[model samples]
Target: MSDLEKKVKQFIDRHKLIQKGSSVLVGVSGGPDSLALLYFLNKHKEMYDITLTVAHVDHMLRGKQSFEELLYVKNICKDWDIPFEGVQVNVNEISKESSSSIEVIAREVRYDFFQSVMKKRNISTLALGHHGDDQIETILMRLTRGSELKAAAGIQVKRPFATGTIIRPFLCVTKSEIEDYIKMNNLIPVYDHTNEEDIYTRNRYRNHILPFLKSENKNVHIHFQQFSEQMLEDEFFLMDLAKKTYNKVVSKEKNGDLTLNLIEFRKAPFPLQRRCIQLILNYLYNGELPKDLTSIHIDSIFELIDKTKPSGQIDLPQNLKVYRSYDLCVFTFHVQTKKPYFLNWDKGKTLELPNGRQLFMKEGSVPDDIGQNIFILDENTEFPLYVRTRKNGDRIRIKGVGTKKIKSLFIDLKIPHNERDVWPIVTDQEDNILWVPGLRKSIYEASDFTTGEKVILQYK
Candidate 1:
């Protein structure tokens, strides 16, 4: 076997990228790297006991040139007697119709096509041609763009995709090695001119940063691949720990709010704490993190937990609210500002509030024991009672203690800021605040032995 073949064979065996009798689909772009990968896989197909199929995407960015590359790959597959699958997509037009760039749209289209083909053919593996140099570029680019450590780990060699797994057998070899292989095999691979331009970030790293690094260390790509593998391993272990820690310290409410126990969260190491926050954000965002979410937002959460103040809040992108009350911190996508509403209550009727709560009013004998969620009013207390949200400068008269601001009451009760606006406030026709449901009641609460009929208000 040739040196290149031996190296790739060892790498694949080490990673267990392909199983015996596996059906492998190769993504061929008619470039040196991909073409080399295709040739290598086909040459060793029988030895590995695997079936090979070639898949190509004509991005239609360069008009006829792109289509010709697709044709070249298809013809090569025909000559080798390998099954071929190809698609033509107007990526430029798609980009124009959406907010995504051409590069982003092209990658999405290519991957979607590859996944569809894999699913249809029941393929067990999709092999790609990303090389060691590509790994180095991806790492540097992500780090330069302020990516977190997990993201900086860069492209993975093997990961789960559509119906099976996507494997990168070329990651063990450098771009120069792939070029050398192509030349030795007498293969004619079409090149994309755009790859030579510096306008793209990856090209910039490849054209300028890569040569400098290679000059410093002839085998830098190997060290980078080692670094990437190590980082991924470490990240995987830490993230597993973080997920366990999260399950222990966080509880999900029925309303889709996440309540984390700060006391328990702080018991973990700093690394786990950071990852727990990331896990929370990922869960809350349903795995698609907002672009604006960064380390700064995470740091603010840590600050909120560490602060001496018992209650505080910070707003995040996409209407996410993170707040702390006592030892509990909540992450929710609920709206912070509730609309102010004034709802009138009729006797023996339930009024549905905008905040998904019900307020019921009735005339009956006052109970000796009244809970925070229940209020009793004097029989002569005025008609047309109202249940509305708190207004500015709203205060309730507390027996013997005089009047207190609703805002102060909320603060004293440690109510979350987002909930205070929607808290039900019971009042009389004269606009006299009677009670704050599930909280405090006013001085007008009647006694059980009162001579007249009493009004009972219950909030649920």
Candidate 2:
């Protein structure tokens, strides 16, 4: 067996990247990296005791070239007697809608389509041909773009993906090694013109920094491997620390929201505390940690806790707001811009929430139309509704009960600490909260939609 084949097989055995008799979905772009991956893995399929199929997604941006590439991939799979699946999508429209870069959109589309194939065909692993050199490019780019420790961390050799698992056996190899393997095997790989265009940031690094560094260090490829190894090790340590610290201060509610105990977090080391915060935020916001977040923002947040200015607030980019609440610090991500979690509470009728949800108001009884359920409010109660994040002074009146502090109510209702503030609260003009949207409406403003003429409520 070839050295590349042996190394890949060893990684697979060590990590259990693939299972015997398991269906593997290959994410092939027909590039040198992917081509080499497919060839080597296919050659050793019998030894690995795995069934393999190739999946290709054509963004159709390159027009005929993309189609040809897809066709080439299909033919290659045919030659190997492996199943081939191809999908074509207009990522242009998707990019605009998702507000994602073309590369990001392509990645999502590819994974989504591949996941569909996986479900349809019962495939377990989505294998990609991302080599060690690609990991270096990512690290360099992230470091240049001002990244945090978590952001600068290198890729994992194997990850538990949403569908099943994603493995990159080629990560142990380099781009040059893959190209060499392709040439040795007389492989025909598709060329992505975009990689050379330097239009995107990665191309910029590949063109400018990588070559220059390569000249400076004859064995720059080896240097990339070393860097990835070190970064990978550092990443594991931080993540492990984050995991341990997260368990110390974090708990999840029945509703699936996570609670982070600031009181407990206050005791841990700064790095573990920060890592825990990043982990929670990353899961909530989903995908790549905030790039623009600076040491200044981090310090400012600490100041909120440090200087006893718990009531202070700071707004970071991407509609993320950080506030300190005396006992705890809260970070809220306003997921939607235009909506802004608006709820206009009127005297009589129903007040609709932003999420196509209705908060019905009637004089006496609860409505039968309870998909999301409705809230009752009375005219003698609070007026001119205000919706905002949970504040230190926040309080709520439990139905059939007296009153409770927001923090106590959080413990009572099992509201997660991390989510307590970010949870939208509807308050009257006097700052008296009328309802904790989707949870409860204030007893003071309990309504039956009888007093007001129309259902006057603002929804996002």
Candidate 3:
């Protein structure tokens, strides 16, 4: 076999990225790196029992030139008898709507298109052309941005993606090797103008930082790649330990709140403690760690835990709040809205809450089956049904008990104070609490059983 094929096969075997008879989808952009990847994989498909397909995404920014690139990739796939699929997206429109830069939007749209193709084709593996050079650039970028050790691990060789796995077979190979392979095969590859422009951060790193480092050490890319691999090993160990620590001390509430047992948290090692905090933020943000959660933010959390005061709090990114009240440290997103969410109860349709939650109200007898979020309103209710957060002077008539303030009820339930501000409440026109989801039902004894028409309120 050829040198390029040998190197690629070794990398794939080392990473165990592709199993026998794996159906692979290649993300090709008609560039040198992608074309080189397509060539190598196509030549070795029979040996590996691999089925190959290519996906191309046009950002629609370069107009005719963009279409030309897609056509170029299509022609190449045709010569190899591989399936080729392409899509065009209005990146400018997406950027405006998302309030993000064109570069960020383009990356998101590109990956989205790749995932769609994987799903449509039932491919089990998605291969990309990221090389050692890209890894070095990423590490340098993370270093300058004050990222943590995990961020410094750079691009992974394989990661879960779109019902399968994303493998970077060329991660161990350098850009120089790719160019050499293309030259040896007498093939031409298209160049993207955007790579030459220094406006983007990656381009700046490629054009300036990498060259400077290469001057200091001729094999700087190899050195950086080795360093990143070591970091990845250490990161994996720390992450595993952190996950175990999290399971032990962290308690997750149904209402998107996380509580850390402060007594137990303080006993763990410092590394686990820091990772625990990171995990909490990631959980609150739906597995995406907040970008602004820096070392400073983490240190502040430790400081809050050390404070002598029984109750202390610190604000975090994305409207998140971390506070310690006696034995529990709560991590929650307290959305402080100048205008509270007030909506008239619509029994026919679902009411969309601020944070992707939904409120459903229906007029019927209580359903035999119910979830934690479901509540029942008395059929003889005399007041109008409205949904909003707690307001001062709000009172609820607890079932089998006398009237109590909402504030007192929250305290009695040990609900994190930070979450109480945004905790949704369903109230009647007289401002009487009908139901506090996952907590209690109304005590207003109304004889609704005669008609048996109940207003069922559910938050999901």
Candidate 4:
């Protein structure tokens, strides 16, 4: 009946955030924003027939304070009679394993936990506590990182994330509104000290960039928010156009590489070309694709495509390669051909490559003692593994054939020269060849299947 309730109702209705009797799993951190969210959503339980859950992630970065925060959140959920659950993760280990920052790792681990809970409970909606402040901070951060107009578009009210839909009912609401609600309702939420420190990137935006922008314009947040919404509209149109253009110009080869028609892409406008490149990147490389590969990167790709020789290769950041071969711009995973990235391959484990990447290996059988890495190695296998880029002197033997320089082999194999650098090679401690990971193994090792060798390598 109050104005806040009306506003919440309007937001959910405008976004169609949930259906009547729909269940939402809320990401709560015992912070003011999430606490206020729980209060309002719970208050309207009857009208919407909504089922609510409070899920918290204890990052364990703040020592005892982190545990206390979790307990506080648990108690709050108890007071409201809401279902409460949480998970604790060693974010450092995850960051190291995934080659991601702690911020990214925490998000991944938290979302993984949240989705598992949602799936088990048959929940359809995942509610985040992000407000206008978070939105402005995000935009500023993206901008600082060289995001263009379309990339600077405001975050959506609701978008598909993880297994289900993630809805932000507070996009229209400012941080002050959430705080006022908490203050008026006597809400007690834990304050995270990290938010005050500029150690994290987001904190830098929150602590400095936003305040400076506010000081200069006084209405910078609102202006950017509006700008974002408008940009979103434009982006939506561009993406649709890109999709149409992509369908006309893009095809897939039998080898799973994307083939973009150079003539068609060159014919389209620059924006369309950029969008098409983005689309190709998104579709070909699955799982959390960077929505914003720089214009420079895109333009570089364009230049490569425009002058691309048959089977020509271009390398972009994040290990993305654009192959201009066979009259198609084949977007490929930027795999090092010469030296491969190292995965700690022990006696018993599957080393998962970056998502959706298939490590191409030469046809082979394994001896029983030879490890998965060295499919056909004898007892005299190399150690202290060296995974590096290709050197000039590298050589490999062809089965029943004599040895040949690896360089000549690649050239003969029609491997795009730029792509040759991205293929990973594995070596032993003595710097001897063990495997050309995802490709051919060096001839120093025997390919004849011997005892204790198991050769079952697969990509999923």
TM per candidate: 0.86, 0.67, 0.73, 0.67
Angstrom error of the Cα, residue 48, model 3: value is 1.3
lDDT of 1: 0.88
User: What is every candidate's alpha-carbon RMSD to the true fold?
Assistant: 3.8, 10.0, 8.2, 12.6
Ranking by TM-score: 1, 3, 2, 4
Instruction: Using lDDT, rank the candidates from best to worst.
Output: 1, 3, 2, 4
Question: Which one wins on lDDT?
Answer: 1
lDDT of 3 at 116: 88
- Clashing residue pairs for model 1: none
Candidate 4: count of backbone clashes, pairs at least 3 residues apart or interchain? 29
Candidate 4 per-residue lDDT, tens place, 1-460, comes to 5566677778789768887888989999988888888888888888889999989999888878898888888988888899998877778766777867788788888999889989888888899888877889888777778765565675777778766799888776677778889898999988878788988888887888777776787656556666767778888898899889999999876556677887777788888878887778767667356654657777777677767355666677677777675455667663534434555444334444433344323334552454334444445653333445677698765456667677876666655565567655556666665555545665556544544543333322
- Model 4, TM vs. native: 0.67
Which stretches of candidate 2 lie above 4 Å from their native place?
Answer: 216-219, 226-230, 233-237, 240-244, 247-263, 283-292, 308-311, 318-320, 332-460
Tens digits of per-residue lDDT, candidate 1, 1-460, equal: 7777788999999989889999999999999988899999999888889999989999999989899999999999999999999999999889888987898899999999999999899997999999999999999999999876778998888998976999999898888888888889999999889899988888999999999999999799889999999999999999999999999999998779999998899999999998898899889999888889887888898899999988898989998988888888989887655788888777787887776678888777777777898887776777678888988899999988899999999888878776788888888888988888888888887755466666688888
Where model 4 places Cα greater than 4 Å from the true spot, the runs are 1-6, 148-151, 215-220, 287-294, 307-313, 317-328, 332-460
Q: Residue 383 of model 1: what lDDT?
A: 66
Residue 143 error, candidate 4, Å: 1.3
Top TM-score hit: 1
lDDT-wise, the better of 1 and 3 is: 1
Local accuracy by lDDT, each model: 0.88, 0.72, 0.82, 0.72
